[model samples]
Target: MTIDRSSMTALKVTLIGFAALASAMGVGRFAFTPLLPLMQAHAGLSLRQGAWLAGANYIGYLVGAMLCSMRVPATRHAVRYGLVAVALLTLGMGVTGRYDVWLVLRFGAGVASAYVLVGVSAWALPALAGHDRSVWSGWLFAGVGVGISLAGLLVLLAGARGYPPAASWLALGLASTAVAAIAWAPMRAAGASAAASAATQHAGRLSTDDWRLVLCYGTFGFGYIIPATFLPAMARDVIPDPAVFGWVWPVFGATAALSTVAVALGSSRMKSRRVWAIGQLVMAAGVLVPVLWPGIAALLVAAVCVGGTFVAMTVAGLQEARRIAGVNAARLMAAMTAAFALGQLAGPIVVALAATNGTRHAAGPSLLAVALLLAGAWALWRSPD
Candidate 1:
């Protein structure tokens, strides 16, 4: 089927873009959050063990992002295959009891998620920009939050009916596969023209502002990742009931979707750099909220703060790169993603090492360090270049 890009309206394009992201990222990547406590309940995972699993996934993400920046042929087909691979990896998690197997599956899922992310951005953003419908890109980024919320809601319902974490994994995998099928053809065909187009970019000659963006991006990764990874665990420890604390992930997702949409609607008046800076600062405050209060209420607030701003910061930072780098956006985006991946990769490792003392209580000081790093990112983002 020859799909005509010109014939597709903004609404269709937006939904297709959203499905691609929702499938690849929302379920493929984050179905882990709600599954974490369930894994603890059923699979006997400790905090440090869980951090290692998450770390493996982050390392895979860094590799995928780096590969996405390279000029690869038939990338749309690669993305389609990647989505199928993600679905399989997600299902594989349910059948495996071995921790090493779990790590490899999660790592594969991470690679798939990055492919979908970069592929969708490569396909959808430019198409929307061509149509003057760039605002719809918010819906694209918001797909991650939506995926997170949907998976959370699914697990919440499953737990209410006494479903195990394995069931949750299977259900989310099926859900991802279903969505992947719908967008498979569209995603495979949507952005083919740009797949081969790499703008001329000089390596080893980044400007001061470019390095600044990379540093801030990395710090934002470190800042958001800890709370993002462990928030539900903290909630489960405190609440001990899936039905109640399960709501936290959904709330985080809701805040993220709403906030991204709101920011996108106002992007014309607000510069992406400013938006990125504001998001970094707001995320810093969110990271601190749970630390200061340490309860369901504060955790919920932390969810909103982190979920709401992380996507916003992502949109702002990546879009800002496009604004500054023009056709060279792909290279710069890849560099920033590598740095960001490094930051998140370190986040879980930090937690794992901190927990080596055989205490789950190591998150406090580590998170405090993450918050301070976010503060420094905010300062760099605001300081004159």
Candidate 2:
């Protein structure tokens, strides 16, 4: 059977969207976590300061999401402009040597990354209908895993070859630029068509139920980021083996990718909110494992669980937001993104308090936060539609 041109076009656009998301998320966000040690050793930043610098990115992301939510011509042009901004920011990160300078660059990169994510999703979701949209959305989030894996591998390779930190950052930036170029053509082509017009309009607003979904999703974002941002460092502190550190990130990425698929399948029959809550509970359990056991095995298990839930919660959250918001989906999604970013910004700071006593103690507050938020999500799911 022959597929229509629109179907083929949508498929291409979907692929490109995945690539774009991978670059934007993997290289832009996850890369920083792994590189934190390098930055500290080479750049002379304290743990507290490093955490704050990381939080700065999320703060910028929150601002960017809120800005995109407004109905402005420039905001509407974010799909193309955002991609370009992120690509440039990624490259800029390579050359900056000073901590203050790097912090500013990371904030800029965060803003660009947030815009690309919100804009692309706003554009991509309308190209699909019903279950296909949900499925594709899961796949799109999985792209982040792929990107993380790629970034991990690159970092490993760079370290092995004794490449300077600056060079490694540059290589990732180039990879992002390549992906952006490939994505631009199809995104533009897709956006020009009649179907694109309808999809954009369909993505315009948010309903009351969408607000509930956003709150739950925002909580998930808060719960999940603490572990994700710090897991590698946690593993290193516990394991201290270079070999183990190398494996931790890739394991997290691969498992997270697989988990996104699991979430998509599980949610096929389950409510999106339920699926999201389940993922969060799993994540909470993961975060607690290392606290309870303090071993390499437990750390690895924690990595897998946390990684999986991260993508799953994102996919479920976005789908629920779209479903509840209908035409106002983009605006609702932007609000949710802002809420999520706020949670992320707060996570490191909250966890750093735990660090004062010891890194392990931080797990208590982190797990509690995740549990409470997830329980709230479950409650929301059971509420009237």
CA deviation > 4 Å runs, candidate 1: 1-7, 70-75, 196-205, 356-376, 383-385
The TM-score of candidate 1 is 0.92
List per-candidate RMSD values in Å. 2.8, 3.3
Worst 10 residues of 1 by lDDT: 195-204
lDDT of 1 by residue, 59-178 (tens): 988888777656432446556777888889988987878899999999999888777776666556666787778898888788878888888899888876778788988887888788
Candidate 2: TM-score?
Answer: 0.89
37-96: candidate 2 lDDT, tens digit per residue = 555556665667767777878888888887866642222356566667777877888888
True-vs-predicted CA distance for residue 315, candidate 2, Å = 0.8
Evaluated at residue 252, the lDDT of candidate 2 is 84
**Cα TM-score per model:** 0.92, 0.89
**Residue-pair clashes, model 2:** 4
Off by over 4 Å in 2: 1-8, 72-76, 130-134, 193-207
